[model samples]
Target: MGDLSLVRALGRGNIPVAVTTSERQSKVGFSRYCVAVVPTPSWVDDPEAALAAVIAWSEQQREPPVLFYQGDHDLLAASRGRERMAGHLRCVLPPAELVENLVDKQRFAAFAERRKLPVPLTRTLCRGK
Candidate 1:
């Protein structure tokens, strides 16, 4: 839903939008504003493969395109591969370590606690303990 909305917003702004998704049923590919739909490997399944696909797609573009990722897997893949992706694509992401910490619920809880971010109390449960 958010992806679709983003496509629409960017399209309305005259931005050339390209959507990268592994899901065949993803509606973003069908969006009228989408200039291209690049099929990528599922980042959760193969981060390296997905990042490679993204970089390969960027290589076809006249200029490095801004990359917008919607989920944690994509975010992590982009963050970890920031160096390799530097000349191929452009992304606005936090530091890789911060990206990793924010994606893990327990780690995010600890991070927030350490920073006194005013988040609600967070507790982790261990199984078979």
Candidate 2:
């Protein structure tokens, strides 16, 4: 959802957009605004290669592009690899500690509750239930 919204917005400004996805079959990557669609390694299966791909692409660009994080995985990856990536691109991601804290489900839930924020009820389901 965020990906499409961002892509369209960039399109409006006539910024060249490129995206990495599990495959070229990704509908979001096919938007008319998109100029390049690079299929990426699965984040779960090979995070290192995925990170490398992003860096490789950015380095090839004559002018560094503004990078956006699509989700927690992307955010965390960018945060962790910021130093390496920032050399070639303007990578935007929250601090690594902040990303780590927010991505931890239990910690996030507790923080939300402490701040009197609404939190959905969660239960740990047992195996074979």
Candidate 3:
């Protein structure tokens, strides 16, 4: 999904892009939209490892590239490792407090409600002792 948009943007700027996928099947499809396709590990179960791998890949590039995150889990893992990875890559992310508030549905709704903003009706569900 991100590859297509990135390819289009890079093409507009005449920049070369490298797309990495974990699955062999994904490479064929992504290759058509990217300059190169590199196979990477699936970071589903181990996010730290995935973050490390991506950080390592970014460090190898001579010209720093913009990184875009498409998945919520991946975004969270990257946020947690921001201090360690700050120098190696650039992450376009919302403020930490904003991200935190948005991720928690209840907190987000309550905040919006407090401000008299338009938010859906929300209620907490609990198990009584």
Candidate 4:
């Protein structure tokens, strides 16, 4: 859903977009705004492989493309590999610590509390809890 919306929004501005999805059945690949649909390794299973796929695909492009991500996994994979993708891609990524804090609920809750952000208290439950 997010990919579809993003592609449509970009398309309105005549911006070309390419998508990388772990699922071959993703409908975003069929959107007219999508110029290319690349299959990437699942970020949930192996982030390193996903990042590698992103870099490899980016390298094959004629020019460095802006990296836009709607999913947390995509964001993390991109953030973790920002350095490696420097010349091959263009992206705005948060610092590693910030990315970690945002992606991890426990860390985000703690961070929010520390910053006096109005976030509800959060708890972590282990197995058998």
On lDDT, the leading prediction is: 1
What lDDT does the true structure give each of the candidates?
A: 0.87, 0.76, 0.68, 0.84
Top model number, TM-score: 1
Candidates 3 and 4 compared: the better one by TM-score is: 4
TM-score of 4: 0.90
Provide the TM-score for each candidate, comma-separated.
Answer: 0.92, 0.79, 0.74, 0.90
Better of 1 and 2 by lDDT: 1
The runs of at least 3 residues in candidate 2 whose Cα sits more than 4 Å from the true structure, single-residue gaps closed, are 110-129
RMSD of each: 1.7, 3.0, 2.9, 1.8
How do the candidates rank by TM-score, highest first?
1, 4, 2, 3
Q: What is the lDDT for 5 in model 1? A: 89
Candidate 3 local lDDT, 1-129, one digit each (tens): 145666677667876666656767764345444766545666566767777777778787885556666676667766777886787877778877777677678879978887898877898888993
Q: Return the lDDT, model 4, position 62.
A: 90
- lDDT of candidate 1 at residue 61, scale 0 to 100: 89
Worst 10 residues of 1 by lDDT: 1-10
> Model 2, 16-41: lDDT tens per residue?
88988876588878899999876678
What is the C-alpha local distance difference test score of candidate 4?
A: 0.84
Candidate 4 lDDT over 1-129, as tens digits, reads 138889999988999988888898889999999999878878778887877887889888899888887878878888888888899888888798999899988899999989999987788889987
Worst 10-residue stretch by lDDT in candidate 2? 38-47
Candidate 4 wrongly placed segments (more than 4 Å): 126-129
